[model samples]
Target: MEIDPDLQGSVESSHDPIPTVVAGPSGIRPSLYAASNTSASTSTTSFGIRDPWRVTPDFAPSVGSSSGRSVHRSDTWYPAVPSESRKFEILYIPDPSRAMMKKEAALNLGWTNRDITPAHFESIKHLTGLVYKTGRTKDRVKVLVTEWLWILLQMDLFENSEAFDVRFMQWQDFRAIILDPTNDIEGWNMLAKVDCIIGGIDYSVDHSGEGNSYHLNMDELARYESCVAQLASQTLFWPPIRLARQASMKWNTICHLQMIARLHGSYTPRTVRLSTGQDIPDDVVLKRSHSECAKHVILPTASRSRRTWEYLNAHTDKYEFWMAQEYVQSLDQIGEWRVFIVGGNVISVVHTYKTSDDGWKGTVTESFLTLDEIREIVEKEPTPIRPADLRRKIVNPESGAAPIRSRARDDFMGFVLTTWKHLVARETRDTGAKPSICLFCRVDVGIRIDMSGQAPPAYFVNEVERSPNTSIWLRFHDNTMGTLADTFAMVFKRWLMDIRNPYIL
Candidate 1:
């Protein structure tokens, strides 16, 4: 059933927190609009000057030589075409039947993992780093171009805003459904029943290559055909309907769950003004997109007749059986949820402070926790903890003690400085690069001393140093004015991106 019309006035839950893990004073960075304005020419543009795909009016002028002639001609370099390996998209499909199953069955059957996020879904923590590394517009082009065509093709795929046209199932749906994390094992096992497989099927780009020449490599296409052939030979493993239903129950439910997870993203409503100054929002409502009716069980005018026989017939298929959801625009509207699994490598380090100025203090407390300590805390406790708990166990956070002096703050800052030195030293020790630097100042000042009256330059305040000297008696102070967890979070996030496959150099 199409749910776009009835859910226009849906309201947000009052108790839910803001849908982002914002730090300090800022909100989560906003996601980009799925649609972008295209331009006629190719030229590199600066940030905020023009959209990534569009041409800008600003042009650079060439300088003349002493002879009053142009010295150098400006030429636009042609970017190389990207190989298909460098472009991919995360396709989504909704599976209501498997979502309805119990938690144990979900996990044991490989349905659900860590909290609510299914085992199949991977976290988006890697996206930012990947984008930064590749910066390829082809990734964007493939998704946007194909998606635009999918919108036009959906009309033919559906029958008059009712159920999916049984005979008109598209290969797009097959790709999406296979990628969805919530499909039931029994549902997949029943794939043999579908005419799409039994009938002579055409999924090759060659069939689609007549006009575009966007053909898959012969070796890759042969591998795909071979896999399909193997699956066909193993028909007993995934029999059609009745027999398959009985067989799927015998295997552990989690065993059927694939490593790939469902895409639980949503879309938000937005308006964009074109160069023509025309404003357009997502007003197109498609029946196949919404599932709110199934939530409320209130059939909409667009839904087909709720017939038992038809429901059962559709039950044999995955795409048609999904509960109707609503239409939205950007996927950013869907609140993200992550299931963090703990347990990783562990290391121990000691803070052998050489002097009193080697520690970091806070407004009330100080921290001596090393990165190894912090990583240990993250692994042991899956739930969120207060920033104060992450500090050195020596300081009493609840005491409400008076603030310390800037000198005391410097003394306590040793943990962070030493951690950075040790990390760089360990990682690139063989390169013969200098890794040690003054804690009070990141530069290799060479001399470390107690400068009682010395105050750092204004530029370093709230950054390299947080606590500024205010009074004579307060020689040591703490700067809990900012969240230390946030500082560490930024570092860890960057590290995660660097370590992932297809490493961003």
Candidate 2:
């Protein structure tokens, strides 16, 4: 049957099957929950504990806010199926087993069905098309989509990279087998591909406890995984034109990397240009991935419970692109930058830069700023000096070495403005997309979009360690160690050297 263009076709038009995992002897409890916690609101926020019986709409008390009503009320008994108005519906339930499973599954799963309206999915597709332009080639898109699903599965505990590697081939050899035909003979690559398809979201980690939070019960787990895998399986098998498109896109990324390197002098290339513009050649330039730039830097002193690096690294493929760029400048002008504390060690800085030739009128560049001397700036007082008078130095003490402050804060600001000008020029010529304002700085100095158009929920900045009081909170952590003087310098440095990339899915 011809499917509606709007429906992803993951779920068919057949009558909705009676959910197999019903409200046992307790009777049916209305679950207002969503399909996946893929809601953009929760995308950056912590996955806090949720109450299964709580009505989904009632939870929207505001972003960053979750209640303890569900906590202290341990004896509060919810019916098997609560009133639909105040319930969270998970996709499916286990067969009277896994009762110990946290009811968060209900909230996470319910959101997909209840929260993500058809309009939201359409917008996602529209945004995806806009950012990617021509869709990526079939092979590359498949690999990326496969990688993304694998990362998600890894998060949900279907199986991890290590397990998959052992079952299919050596972890190190897996990439080689997929890419090289001469070295691979047994067609293990094809078998590996099949494993990826079947395992999509249903894979599970065997361990238990809070760590077991990674795994969902079988019923709910299978639903989401099947959705993605089934969608992928419906496409025509590896079309020829798709391969060419993937090759072209990869080539484009590489070319952009090289061109940016030349402009910043991060590489040896003298100059390169697309039909639109030319590259800037300078030795002290920096190039970073989008992953590095959008990272939610969190400070350590703010919280004790945290996800360790080992845990995050387990899903590196999902987050390899998260990163940051550092710019060196005078230490005096830090207070002017918008700063936030994410955790004890992480400090988040945001700023924009104008091209070198024009005043602040040129294209603006946005980036995440990092610095070694961040603490000093956060603690010190502000100065009245202008940023244009500071001295500038492109080279630090040594390669792969962090920069130390050598001059007064005013001097650092001068250097920062100069470097920022260069960055603006480069970004304007590269990706034509620019923001009218720097979200971090809250300044109307650059190209920006009406964030209201996207209808972003209200964001609340909390001063204390308690969970956010709102349904969603955009947390920005400042990780730099420096005084107020140092903070200004780091802020200016970020303005000069920060890098920005497209958020194409």
Candidate 3:
């Protein structure tokens, strides 16, 4: 199922957070969009920048000249192609009566703290230090380009609504975030006075290759990042860019699931490597370690997997390395489920089917998740013994098989909830927060039921998303968006004020 329509879209482009761990061999930072926008020329300069941000208007930047200049700041950043001014969209204006301003009451929502974020930032510090240690010319250039792209992309997290798509990520509406710890009526009269504009950067550029290639190789980009962390501390307060990178990036999400599964003995696919074109003992599927979307994942078999790998390598926006996961084998049972969770409640559970139209690299189109499914995906869990009638064809979800659900839907929900709690607990043992603070997220799970009914059904979490994409299959657009909007409101509230107490949401 196409659980997340734009999941891989941000990753493929460099606008989203991408840790160095999955940067592949080149370690050359990513800064390009997907097929539709890859070659879009970022060849203009209308930034109207000031000081450190140079004001270069209407020309391609001359590359080699800015290298050795001992200037106070780095030179201006040119665009991949000339594009329009980056525009900001107001996603929501809060109703103050509905917002929680009290320090304790507002904090009741779970927000993540002291976990993947620290590790990721530390990785940035480590890699930049390691790269600059050589002090050679090329090393300096790459580090300069990498760090610049990283900062622009980080800021783009809020600016580009099409890329981020989540309403609350911008952090303008979080009232409780500014609460005084000891005040019982802290922030009783405080409501965010500004519109939550979903645009961070002054302008947008082709974040793809064209974008990364234009920056001057100077110390300015590196300095810019540190500048934001300290001066823009309020924006980075609790978790804004940190959450996007930690949860939105597929590789990071997989890492989170693996850790949770290991500590609790829960199920996740046995992740294996397939970029080398090694032999596949059984059926295996290719998944982007940092991207999302079922369309991007049209399952490739052992032999064809190599072909898909090659295709991604040729694309400037696509990653060179990805996970070749173990496919779930269904002797008789078949189908997939996308369980949507918001504000710590099960909003809807969807059942998906396979589609006939297929895309390049054998990535077949599947039925998208519809917003109409009622209650749990499955009405009941599978019986201990498999029903004889169900022992039919050997269907593979990797192939074009339609999804199935019954009683297992609730179990899947429970699985996600319990796992999230454990994840919060382990990550926040000393951070002082409860584990029930996750405001919005989605879990894509696969299930297997025995044909002979001898063994119990097995369900594995294929993916997790904090800023999940709401598919076009919605039946209630207005109510869904309204509820969905509130789902993440509290998170941004804490982030806006930089509140970190009474636990994880």
Candidate 4:
């Protein structure tokens, strides 16, 4: 079948049986099509837990239909099926003897980012696809990475990498392999071998009495620089653990207001403390300062933010930090930009937004924001900031009753571009630390066209992730460059070639 011309995922016809999955009692499994007028909307939010039950990658399934077979995961449409023949494939692994069955995945995944190209991509379209079988079958794993994963894992960089056995298993399965007591040996081996290990959203150490938390000795975890060569320990996390923390755990998120202050200006939402008489809107957003994702973030319909703040403050000894931030109205229904920087240069900016054929409901889909589109935002925006229509305000600008500060025209560099420029500068110039010492980084920024006459359009930094999730690497394009994946391949290849190559962006 052909993909729709528009950005959203759509089904032109339901006459044919597409290879989609169904959410059964045992989670998402292959099944026949439902053949109904059902569109989906994933639970992906700027902050909060993503319900994996509806974890549909291709598009959100109509889980609430009630009569349909079922709908599990946020976006669980297409599933990873085993192909008869495989060249570059992904091997869904089992903890105990998984290594005994297959060779170890090459540290560099055979090719660096530079090896990726359009010609290679076209040729491999039919050649490289996922192959997965459930039980003790000879072709059990040997699964192709391209099936369920987005561009990040499907990057031609991982060609034949799956033959060695590193694959994307669900959180529960993966957790058992790594954290389970029985498979500690294999887990230790991976920790010592893989270049880096970042526990995605689902990773967290279970706190029996108080639910699971992401405090994997985060404070004491060794720095990325120290754990490059060797990392292993039989006892859970041994040697130097190079696990990447989520954006929320980073310095800026923990102390957002102050971090913005250090930027010489705040390109973020107007944040304030409830105790300091910070104005709270009826539709306010409460941010969790110290955790991963917005685990405990509270979204209220009324302005009872003070109670939430007081509660967190009262139990400071037990909980993480909390902040009351003004909810910046979105430019699009789901407008969140994640800028992928490889060695300091912005290669791709992922735009995750909600799409719907029916307009009323839709699921979140991720795509890259091309350079041409980036230029259009500025070229298209009106010269004057439409403050009146941007958002409702409690204080009048002329009277200055609330006393608010805003960014100037020159200070803004569009939302996507601004994220990169400001983050690198803040980390290096302001913090006086080596900026982004990792192979790559992802800076998330939110954009809105609402603001005062002085600065009508505004962009704010949301996160600075050193080891961003692999999902950020989605299909990217450039009119000038035939295939941008090749560019990313080049960066990663250069780094893998020699860590001392000096372009350590």
Candidate 4 to truth, TM: 0.44
Q: Summarize candidate 3's per-residue lDDT along 277-392 as a digit string, tens digits.
A: 55544456666544534424535443564445466564324332456666665511344555555434444445443323431111112222211221122223354333322221
- C-alpha displacement of 225 in model 4, angstroms? 18
- Give the Cα error of residue 54 in candidate 4, in Å: 36
| lDDT (Cα, tens digit) per residue for candidate 1, span 1-505 | 2222111321222221212122321221122111222222211111111211111122211111111111111423422221111111111122112122232232221121121111111221122211111122422211111111222123222223121111212333443323331343333333333212311122111121223122334443333333334334433111112221211221111111111011112111111211212221223222211121112122232344332334434322222222222222111111111101001110111121112353322122322223233344444555644333433332322332233333323333332233223333332232232111110111110111111213210100000110101010111223211122222222222222222212111
Q: Each model's RMSD to truth, in Å?
A: 28.4, 23.4, 23.4, 20.9
**Which lDDT values do the candidates have, in the order given?**
0.22, 0.23, 0.33, 0.34
> Each model's TM-score, in the order given?
0.17, 0.19, 0.44, 0.44
User: Which scores greater on lDDT, model 1 or model 4?
Assistant: 4
Judged by lDDT against the true structure, how good is candidate 4? 0.34
**Once model 1 is optimally superposed onto the true structure by TM-score, how far is the C-alpha of residue 310 displaced, in angstroms?**
73
User: What is the per-residue lDDT of model 2 for residues 10-46, given as tens digits with 9 covering 90 to 100?
Assistant: 3332222222212222222122212222111101111
